[model samples]
Target: MTRCLRRIAALALVLCPLAAAAPAAAQDSAAAEALFNRGLADMEAGRYETGCEAIAESHRIEPKLGALFTLAICESRSGRIAAAFTHFGEYLAQVDQLTPEQKSRQGERPKVARQEHDKLARLVPELSLALPPGAPAGTVVKRDGRVVDSAALGAGVPAEPGEHVVSTQAPGGPVWETRIQLAQGEKKRVELQVKDTSAPPAGGLSGRRAAMVVAGGVGAAGLVIGGITGALTLGKKSVVEEHCGSGIGVSDETACDQAGMDAADSASTTGLVSTIGFGVGLAGLGAAAVLYLTEPTQREPTAGATSRRIRAGVLAAGPQGVVLGASGVW
Candidate 1:
C-alpha cells in the first residue's frame, strides 16, 4: 500500500504540470488563430503593411504551415520582394516534412510558392563593391550602415530597389563614401578609393547659413510686395480725392459720392496690404540677420566627407517680383 501511494504521488506531480500546460497551450493557439484571421481580413482590405506584421507575429507565436505560406504571400504583395522570396523558399523547403495527408491538403500551394520565389529572384537588385588597386589591407565596407563581409566585396549581393549609401574605411585612412540608386533587377558596382585628407574639408553652407538665405529671400519678396502695393495705394488715394471732394484743392465732405466711397475703400485695402507686407519684410529680415550673426564661424566635416557647393541668389527679376533660386552639388 505504501509503495502504490508513492507511485501515485509521483505520477500526480508530473500530470499536474502537464495539465496546467494544456490550458496555456490552448490559449496561445486560440490567440494565434485570432491573429491569423485578423491578418487575413486586413490583407483583404488592402492594408498590406499591417497585415504582414500581424501574420508575421502569428507565425512567430504558433508557426503553422498555413501561416508561413500566408506570410510569404503577404510580404510579396507588400513589395518586400526579398523577404517574400526567402519565406517562400522556407515554405517549399518544409513542405516535404509534412505528412502525406497534409501535403495532399496543401494542393498547388507548393507550386505557387516555387513560382513566386523564382519571380522575385529576378526582380531584386544587386550591388557589387570593388576596391581600387593598391588599396590598404583591412579595408572595411558598409552598406546602409551595416557591415559588409569581405568575401562579399567582389560578388554581387541582392539589395532592395532604392537609394543606398556605401562607405569604405581603411585602417588609419580617411573614409570614402558614395550614394547609388538601384531599380528593380538592376545591377550596380561602386569602386572604393581612399579619401584625400591633406586638403581642407569641403562642406558647403552650414544649416544656419541655409536658413539665412531662405529668410533673406522671403524678406526681399516682402519688400517688393510692399513697394508695389504702396504705389497702388497712392494711385487709389488720388482717385478717391478726385471723386470724394468737389474738385481739386477742395475739401467738401458732403460732396462725396458712391464712386468716391468705392475709391476710398480700395485705397484702404491696398494700404492694409502694404502695411502687412512691410511688417513681414521687417520680420523676415530680422530673422535672417539673427540666424546669420549667431551662426558658427566654422564647421567640421563629417566622416566619409563629400564635397558640396550650395549657391543661393536672386535668379531673376520681373514686373511682378524677383525669383529666388537655390542649388546644390553633392
Candidate 2:
C-alpha cells in the first residue's frame, strides 16, 4: 500500500504540469485553425492576396504541411510562380512524413509544381554587366543606386522585365554608364567603357592664371600710385623753386622758403616709396606669370580686398603747428 501511494504521488506531480499547459496549447491550436479557415474563406471570397498572407502567418505560428500547400497554390495563382515553385520544393522535401492517406489526397501536387518551376525559369529575364579593361580595381557596381555584390558582378543576375540603369564614378576617372530596357525571356549583356575625364585642354584659364590676371591689375594700380607720387614730388619741387629759388624778401616769402625746405625733404621720401612700390609690382607680376605657366594644377582662389594709404599733398606750415602731408586712402 505504501509503494502504490508513492507511485500515485509521482503520477499526480507529472500530470499537474501537463494539466496546466493543456489550456495554452489548446488556445494556440485554436488560433492556428482559425487563421487557416480564414485563409480559405478569404480565397473563396476573391481576396487571394490577404488569403496567401494569412496562410503564411498560420504556417509561421504552426508549421503544418497543409498550410504550406495552400500558401504555395495561392502564390502560383497570384502570378508569383517563382515563389510558388520555391515553397513547393520545400513542401516536397518534408511531404514524405505525411501518412499514406495524406499522400493520396494531395495528388498531382509535385507534378504541377515542377511544371511551374520550368515555366517560370524560361520567363524570367537576366542581365549581365561587364566592367571594361580600364575600369579601376575595386570599382563598386550599382543598380538603381543600390550597390551590387562584388561576388555577383560579370554574371547573369535574374531580373524583372523593365528598364534598368548602370553607372559608376564621374570625377577624375572615366564615366562608365549604360541604360538598358529588358524584355521578357531576354538575356541582355552590357559592357561599360570609361571616357577620358582627367585633363583640361592644353590652354585654359585656371586659378594660377587668374592670379596672374589679378597681378596684372596690381601692376597697373602700382603704376598709378607711382604716377600720383611723381606728381606730388614735382609739385613740391615747384614750391621750392617759387620760394627759395626766388630770394625771400617779404615775410610771406620767408615762410614760403621754410615751407620749400620741408617740401624738398618730403619729396625724397615719397619718391623712394613710389620707386619701391613700382618695382615690387613688376617683380611680383612676373613671378605670378611664371608660376601660372608651370603649376601642375590650378591654385585655390584668393579672396579679399587690398588697400594702401598714401599721404602726398603738401600742407602750409602754420605758427600753431607743423602740418603733415595729405592723409587719405589710395
Candidate 3:
C-alpha cells in the first residue's frame, strides 16, 4: 500500500507543475495578443510610431508571423517603403505554414507588397551629365541635387527614369549643371560645357616670347665675338708666316723673330677667345632648344560644356557624349 502511495505521489508531483505552468503560458500568450491588437488599433488611428512600438513589443514576447506582417503594413503607410518591402517578403515566406483560413485571410498580402515596392522604385530620379574632353575619369555625378554614385558616371549605367537636375565636377574644373527629362527606359544624351580651370595663366605666351628674344640676343652676341676672334686668328697666322719664312736675310732675323713672337701671342689670344665664344654659342643654342621643347602646349577653348552619361550598371557614353566614373558621386 505504501509503495502504491509513493508511486501516486511521484506522478502527481510531476504533473502538478506542468498543470500549474500551462495557465501561466496561456496568460503570456493572451498578453502578447492584446499588445498586437492594440498596435493594430493605433495604426488604424494614424499613430504609426505607437503602433510600430507596440507591434515590436508583441513580437518580442510571441514572435508571431501575423504580427510581423501587420508591422510591415504600418511601415508602408508611414512612408518607410524599403523596410516595409523587407518585412513583407519575410511575412509571405512564413505564411506557408498557416492554416487554410489564415492563408485565405492573407491571400493578397504578397501582391500588395510588390505594388508598394514598385511605387517606391518609381521615385528614383533621372540624371543627365556632360563631361569635357580630357576630364579625369571617376568624376562624381549628381542628380536632383543629390549624389548617385561616382561609378554611375560612365558607360553601362542604365538611363535614370524621371525628371532631375544633372551635374558633374572634376578635381579642378568648374561645375557643370543641366536639367533633363528621362522617359521610362529611354536614354537621353546631354552635354555640359565645363570651363577649364587647368588652363595656363594669360601671361604664358608673353613669357615664352620674351625668353625667345633673350635667347636670340645672346646668340647674336656669341656670333659677333666668334667673327672678331676668327679675323684676329687669320691676321696672326699671316704675320707669323711672313716673318718666319726662309726669304728673310741675317740682318733682318732679329726683327723678324720679334714679329714672329708678337704673332704667336696674338694667335694664342685669338684661339682662346674663339674657343670660348664657340662654347658659349653652343650652350645658348642648347638652352633655346630645351626651352622650346619643354614649353607647355596651347589648348583651344571648347564652345560648350563637357558632359557624360550613365548607362547599364556603369557610366557610359550617351549619344554624342562622353562617359566617366569614380569612387563616389556628389
Best by lDDT: 1
* Residues 1-330 of candidate 3: C-alpha lDDT, one tens digit per residue: 999999999999999999999999898899899999999999999999899889888888889777887888888787655456567767767776788898788767757766765664554233334465676765556766777564455432334455556666766666766666656534445544454567455655455556756765665676678778978998898887777655255455435577887897888888777766655554455455555655544222223433332111113422222233233211
TM-score, model 2 to reference: 0.41
Model 2 C-alpha lDDT per residue in residues 187-220, reported as the tens digit of each score:
7776654544563545856555666677677767
State the displacement of the C-alpha of residue 107, model 3, in Å, after optimal TM-score superposition. Answer: 4.2
lDDT score of residue 59 within candidate 1: 91
Kindly report which residue stretches of model 2 are placed more than 4 angstroms away from their true locations once superposed. Answer: 96-102, 124-330
Better of 1 and 3 by TM-score: 1
Error of 2 at 175 (Å): 21
User: Which pairs clash in the backbone of model 1?
Assistant: none
Candidate 1 per-residue lDDT, tens place, 255-324, comes to: 6577778878888887887877766666567667756655433222233556555554456543444455
Error of 1 at 89 (Å): 1.1
Ranking by lDDT: 1, 2, 3
Q: Which stretches of candidate 3 lie over 4 Å from their true place?
A: 98-102, 105-107, 117-330
State TM-scores per candidate. Answer: 0.50, 0.41, 0.35
Pairs clashing within candidate 2: none
